[model samples]
Target: MPHINLLPWRELQRKQSQNKFVTILLLVVLVSFLSMYMLSTYYGNLRDGQNIKNSFLTTEIGHLDARIHEIRELDKKKESLQQRMRLIEDLQSSRNLGTQIMDEVAKIVPGGVYLTKLERRGSAIHVIGRSESNNRLSTMLRQVQNSYLLEKPTMQGIIAGEKSSRLLSDFNMEFYVKPFDKIGEAKQ
Candidate 1:
């Protein structure tokens, strides 16, 4: 039989097995690195997608906020317009009230009573005049009480002067002038 070199053969087999183990370890490390890289890339893409959605939502919310502001401004303008309209209607309705009050005053005046000065403050009327006699003044007061456009005619003050040829008796009287039915009643 030929003599076998077992030492060299065993050494060669040990070197081959060590090389195989190193290669398998390097392959496992490479596979782990690749998987980590893929996972990182996927998470980065997902974060980027989420950021984009957030940006879009922010833009849409800005538009909605602007619309809400515009609507509030329009509502304020509408309220102002409504107030102006109400003021205009009130003015229109009371347009003829002054003339009517004057007409009523003329109708209530008795004969022999002449007004020298007339002043109006709100609904009150101040009359400074001369009457032919005290009886005439009483008659004028009675007429004012019975008239349609005068109420609560409280005689505030009365002054009498010496009798004169041109004027019968000097007097001063203050009374109130009432307004029309609906418009005046609502005020009270």
Candidate 2:
């Protein structure tokens, strides 16, 4: 209404607004940098914690690996010891087999049958003997067949030898010896 000059007032108001905007921008820039630094610190702490856990897991894995190797060694030793024990057991079981077989043969021989040779080859016994007559030789074979320790009695040969006081027949036989446990079962 009045012819008033308002240019200086508008210029001053514009300068004040510009000052306020600069102040607000400076505060915003400082707050942004501070938030970024805080976020970076938090992430770095999280990364350090994860690395520590990973290192602990790796150490535990190494210990477990060592224990596994020890267990494998123990298993091998156990297997070796078991094999030795089995061999000893086998030797122990067969220790008196020869004596037992000889005793049984001596007991089962009938009268007047003279044994010339008694040898064992594997599981079989080879016998060479002289008898007064064929009947006595057959009796010996029957005794051998009925005995508990012998099986599959087989006569290989019989030759009429020269008279030695009486008629003598040379004979050879072969038979398999039964296992001790099997003989015991037969006795029962």
Candidate 3:
């Protein structure tokens, strides 16, 4: 039999196997590092895109807020103008009140009764007058009660006037003016 060196051959085989394992390990580590870098880049791009969208939305919201503020101001101005218009309309509608009151007084006065002072406060009319006689004052009171515009006639006081040639009576009276809406109903 020829003498063969099997030990050296076995040792060479072992070294080759060790080298192959180290090469595979290094390849695996390199591949893992590349995959990690690629995943991080992808996530960073997504984050940047979301940030841009958020900034756009914020700008749009700011514009909408400005418009809302302007709308509120316009509404306030509109309400103020409406109130002024309503006040003017009310003044115009009540313009004939004084004339109506005077006409009513003229119609209610009796022939023998002369009004000296006529004062109106709110719904109450205060009348100071001189009458030819007590009967004339009583007739005036009855006229006031039957008037469409007057009601609740109250005689405050009556006194004999100065000792003149003719007997005269001074009287103070108060009556409430009926509201225009009720005047027609009262007459009916």
State the local distance difference test value for candidate 1.
0.80
Stretches of candidate 2 exceeding 4 Å from the true structure:
99-120, 123-188
Clashing pairs in 3: none
Query: Cα RMSD for candidate 3?
Result: 6.4
lDDT of each: 0.80, 0.88, 0.87
TM-score of each: 0.50, 0.53, 0.56
Model 2 lDDT-worst window of ten: 160-169
lDDT of 1 by residue, 1-188 (tens): 47876999999999999999999999999999999999999999999999999999999999999999999999999999999987887788668778977887788778888889888899888888878787878888888777666766655555666545545767777777665454456455
* Predicted candidate 2 versus true structure: per-residue lDDT over 29-145, tens digit per residue: 999999999999999999999999999999999999999999999999999999998778767867877887888898778888899999899989999998878888788788888
Off by over 4 Å in 3: 1-13, 100-117, 122-188
TM-score of 1: 0.50
lDDT of 1 at 45: 100
Residue-level lDDT tens digits of model 3 in 1-188: 47886989899999999999999999999999999999999999999999999999999999999999999999999999999987786567457767878998898888888999999999899999888887888887898888877889999999888867356788999999887557656757
